[model samples]
Target: MTAFFFALVASFLAATGARDQLLVAGLRARLGPAPGLLVVALASAVATAFLASWFGAQLSQGMSRDASTMFVALAMLLAAFECIWPNRTPRPQEPTRSLGAIAIVLFLRQLTDASRFLVAAFAVALASPTLAGLGGAIGGGAAVAIGWAAGDALESKVPLRKLRLGLGLILAVLAVWVGLTARGLIG
Candidate 1:
């Protein structure tokens, strides 16, 4: 349960990264106002959670504790790098005139988000499969909701450069924390 909770929290924070917000907005604009969008989002969230849980379990079970810690540390470091060195040029906005197209875009965007993988893997490593799935569903769903709400606000209020720097720092800190915890340097 504790592992599930941590996964949930970490996933939420990671998902809320600025790049994801842009993708979701792009998806929403393309999809327009469609009821199917909700369904797609929910389905995507559940499927992602399930997959993540399974993978995380495999990783946790197969790897030594040191290996697991190293993997996570490396992932975190890479994430930090991406966050810090984001593409500076803004993507050309595409006009999404249909709901169906928007749904597809959103789904694809989410599929590529690192948080989905991290959350699922973390959940699996931290707890039983059932717990990991449940945690992922809850965390991913909440993250989508939060992203939807904050996407526009963040775009308007926060500078992308600043957001990236902050996220990079946070991810780095998390990597250190996870490494220490895994090594039993922290309780």
Candidate 2:
């Protein structure tokens, strides 16, 4: 039980990297200080968590612990590469439309996110996919809230280039940690 919750928190921290912080910041800039940002972020979190958990459960069914750990470690490694790589440039100027834009962006980004995979893998370990999914949704939503607040406070003062680099470093650390754990170096 404790481990399950720990994974939820870990997933939140890992998922709420610079990429998401910048994304929320961009969404805020586009929407112009609307209250609906939180709604969309939370909604997207719930939807993404549900899907990710289900997928993880399906994938890990009948898998051994070592295999599952390897799967998660590899995922973290991939995420490290994603974060380290340069981010995509913003598209041409387009007027903001509705909350759907925010939801879509959040959902798409989270579709194969490390956090979702972590939550799903945790669910497989705990044999409680629904609980893991719920916890992941809350954690993901909290991450968004944190990102929104940070973005709002730092807007225009900090360079996103630096933020992106920092996120890559964080993911690299996480990947190392996961790799070590897989190799029996960490508990």
Candidate 3:
């Protein structure tokens, strides 16, 4: 249950205005909120989270609790850094408007996203990959669903870069705290 909640909240925060959300929202704005697109996005989120959680489970098999906790903190630090980094991927020309293409793109984006990283970290810390994966899937799905539902309004209404920066800073602080606690340097 703790794993589920941690992954859910972490994934949701990490996914806000992320590349995947931007992709879904852009598609919705350009093509309308197609149900097929939403389905594909949800599928991609679930698949990516599950794969990450599985990888975390494998890693946790050999680590002590303290080591797993430290690893989770490291993961959080990585996520924070990722959020702070400037995005340089130029928007590609839409080669096709097919659902399969969209699915592939979304899945690929999630493969390196902060949400998946947090899901994996939580799974390692909690030793509950299934719960972590389910939570991450739901959280990621909700973020994309909002993008689909809001379309251009989401981009126009929200200061996404600011939000990302704020979240990144918070994650960085938490990571430092967690790392210190795991090392018995702080309570």
Candidate 4:
């Protein structure tokens, strides 16, 4: 389906250099490859994507097509800003190495990340929350799996900050164009 493929690609692109993916990669670097940890990451991503898509579906029930488009554009703008912003939160000293703690942290990060927002927006736009959610889950899961497999190599070999900045700028431009079209200012 169009919705599925679109969300899959968008979520995958959005997940690059995301905080959740970075955190998992960092943990893998420190702890070595752990299948259990990858499972946790996948579960968290799936849950976040599903929740967001569901919320988007609910939101779409009451909104007009233009309103949904406008809202999706706004979400894209927020994600762009997040990607462009420097992460200022200092890494906290780990009080515990529990998998539960890791899962909680990963879940929280994914809940607020760009990919989830995109998943939600796509769900609203496409009117197919289930497909959008599944696509987003798979894409986001793949990103986390890559992080797990690559370990420290990801950080060393890739320019994550630069990649994210580029993504941010692209998303911002797309958002503006979408917003303008939604407002009938341009098509």
**Candidate number achieving the greatest lDDT relative to the actual structure:** 3
RMSD of 2: 3.4
TM-score for candidate 1 = 0.73
**Clashes per candidate (backbone, < 3 Å):** 3, 0, 0, 0
Q: Rank the candidates by lDDT, best first.
A: 3, 4, 2, 1
| Cα lDDT of model 2 by residue, 25-87, tens digit | 666666566678877877888888888778778977877887777766666676566656776
Top-down TM-score ranking: 4, 3, 2, 1
* Whole-model lDDT values for every prediction: 0.63, 0.69, 0.90, 0.88
TM-score of each: 0.73, 0.75, 0.95, 0.95
Model 1 weakest lDDT span, ten residues long: 25-34
Candidate 4 clashing pairs, residues 3+ apart or interchain: none
Across 47-115, the per-residue lDDT of candidate 1 in tens digits comes to 776776777777777777677776677667666766676655454376555546755655665564556
Candidate 3 wrong stretches, greater than 4 Å: 88-95
Report how far residue 112 has shifted in candidate 3, in Å. 1.1
Q: Is candidate 2 or candidate 3 better by TM-score?
A: 3
Q: For residues 1-187, what per-residue lDDT tens digits would candidate 3 score against the true structure? A: 9989999988988998899988888888888768998999999999999999999999999999899999999999999988887656654456357999889899999988999999999999999999999999999989999988998798789998899999899999999999999999999
What lDDT, from 0 to 1, does candidate 1 have?
Answer: 0.63
